[model samples]
Target: MMGVVLVAGALQHARVHAQAAGFPDFTTIVEKAEPAVVNIRTTAKVSARSGPQGQDPYEMFRHFFGPDFQPPGGRQGPQQNPRNNKPRAEPEERSVPRGVGSGFFISEDGYLLTNHHVVEGATDIFVTLTDSREFKAKVIGSDKRTDVALLKVEAKGMAFLPIGSAKLLKKGQWVMAIGSPFGLESTVTSGIVSALGRETGDYLPFIQTDVAVNPGNSGGPLLNLKGEVVGINAQIVSRSGGFMGISLAIPIEEAMSVVDQLRASGSVVRGRIGVQIGEVSKDVAQAIGLPKAEGALVGGVEPDAPADKAGVLPGDVITKFGDKPITRWSDLPRLVGETKPGTTSTLEVWRKGKPLTLKVTVAELKADKTAAVEPTPPKVVETVTTVLGMEIVPVKEDVQKKLRIKGGVQVTAVQAPASTAGVAEGDIILAVNDTDITSPTQFVKVVAGLDQARPVGLMVRTGEQTRWVAVRTEK
Candidate 1:
């Protein structure tokens, strides 16, 4: 009987130990994280009537004869003077109150950090501290692309969190989040960093985690184990409209970089290389004599742009830009966008069969606003028939004028190649075997000289739109 009791006691002890090991005490972390997390209350004066056009006809009648209606001048209505009659209280003007979002304190002198969507178009922004004190805030600056904003309050000596380098973060690292989620103030949750360098869209590169992020946690901090701010909880991926273990946070490094720029200037400025590129595929790798299909393959270089001026040709493959490794095509845009214009940088590119180094001055990228044009006549190469019924020749000047292209190949005619591939005449050819074609001669050389059977990419400019089309060669 004594032996049985000892075994049961041991089992109970082990269960208790397991429970204790599973849960971590977040008291200190929460205490440190709470001061930085703030509740954002914004008020916008929405015109009661959506203008004179949307006014309800019945509203005018109700305003005239309602029980609380008052004639413009001072007047008193008949009052019932019964045994327990009391004077009716005056009706007050109705107001609409709205509550939303959260933010964090970033400076001791009352500067706060939050998402642009939080206070955008807000007429009045009120910030509530962890101690329940409130202050009015003003917008200092905002970057819509990064969704980051800087705000200023009238208070000083406020508690703020120090920024930490997100570059050092790695997957599986423990992270803590503090914010007002679901109107619950100072809610704290903990989880591990699920991934790093996550690109949700081409514009947003976020830190992925498993933290429980909800509605009001939009601009809250994702704290590292050392009590430093590593990322800003921004978005989540879920089907049930709630946290299903997938959350995305803006890396503190990128956020801070934008914040610093916004604080310095009213708008953010990004560097441009003036080249359109795509990922290098396995077939392109073998054709280019590369050991692996990594790096960005240049598709087209804008005329007279920094890339063109620096002699960055269409057939060159960019392996590295400055000190950052261009492992994939998507990495180039983000890295270049983060750099400032006029900055001179070194580019490591694979030209022909040898690695070449080129120095380039970054240029300002302008928004694409030009309309597309139709393809021009081909320069007349020995017309080759692919499995597709189209007849393709080299691009010509008349084709360039018809296509409105500064440089590229034109589709001369459509025969079996067109019917089989569904490509019609007037489709300009931009790239073949990942090699860009600027002139008819280059296009002919690239397509006819290729020895492998691989799909070719074409940038088709039709009407007012441009689209990427991939066409396979004859087997």
Candidate 2:
């Protein structure tokens, strides 16, 4: 009888636990959010570059058909098509279907949002509503960096979704996604937030979820339990070219920012500080006396740019830009890009075991492409001295002046610990640990005094990039 009582008690506890883990009912959320969602179809004009009679025009239209297929009219000169008067050789540009995606209206005036790739290169865009009403849409603008586009339709009284904050999202919170996955319009999928602020690129940190997103779901709305749109479904991680339980969304806040800019100027302008940044490793942090591995390590600084003028340098770690703390290397770019140009912002950098603050005037980004590496080193050698298994020599005066360095020793040869640490020939050693080496003789003395048991930090510059390499003195 006691065993039977215990079994009943265990089953009771299990039932209570199940009750606490309440499963969500998504039918209500779908009913409210589905009307705002839209199905997007695009068409592009592609040239059907076959011959006049669809024959192979091999070798400039002479090698095929025994060289008798002369012109568009055979025995006569070039003639126009009877139906359209367009040259027969010039194959008529056809409006072929390009792709299908999803979107959502943001306002009642018919301004909608979708992915930039959806309408990219598209000649015609059409948006279909839940009521089966379709209207032609004109792209207001598109920003490829954020992959967001703004489109406008002639319709009025369209249903729009209320925007929500992704910052307030937490893990395990129920979220819903409405998109046209695989051309299935108004399809609804539900899942909990897998993660937030997931860094997948240098520009935007994505909101990662397990929602069922596929190719046709590129630009749909991701909503919270409040029936507010939180994100735009943008990407997925899969091997079979389909959903694999991982979908990424562009946070609605970020997408709206791009939309505002696109609506105002038909383009998005971003700020540039003119520095190439990289990750700060733990070893580098320890060697530089940083308390923790955080912030962006400056690898290269463009001359005469904002960062250069603000006294930023290679090997310095940027801890903060204005009021925003740079927690990772990729965080800096997004923060800088978001800042308005011509505004003076506060900058904080870690230099030589201390934090230095400076004011920088943010400049408008001229181009989106990365700057090429500069400063081609001159081949000149003088008084080679061997230290740390590296043959070092003073850089020539003209080369130093051209490179704009006050003093540094050029490494001509390397082996063992130095080689293992990635120091290479033609590399310029600018500093040993915390001290700048003024000459080849001084560099040799600095290396001789380094603790053999501990790895020493050497600031080495290769081409336009600078980094700290840690090498133990003993083999």
Q: Which model scores highest in TM-score?
A: 2
* Model 1 regions more than 4 Å off: 1-23, 51-99, 365-384, 387-397, 401-475
Off by over 4 Å in 2: 1-21, 50-88, 373-391, 413-422, 447-455, 471-475
Q: Write the per-residue lDDT of candidate 1 for residues 139-180, one digit (tens) a residue.
A: 888877777888889887888998887888889888888887
**Tens digit per residue, CA lDDT, model 2, 330-390:** 8898889988999899899998889999999999988865656554434654667888888
Looking at model 2, residue 379 earns an lDDT score of 60
Candidate 1, residue 26: CA error in Å?
2.3
Choose the strongest candidate by lDDT.
Answer: 2
TM-score of each predicted structure versus truth = 0.72, 0.81
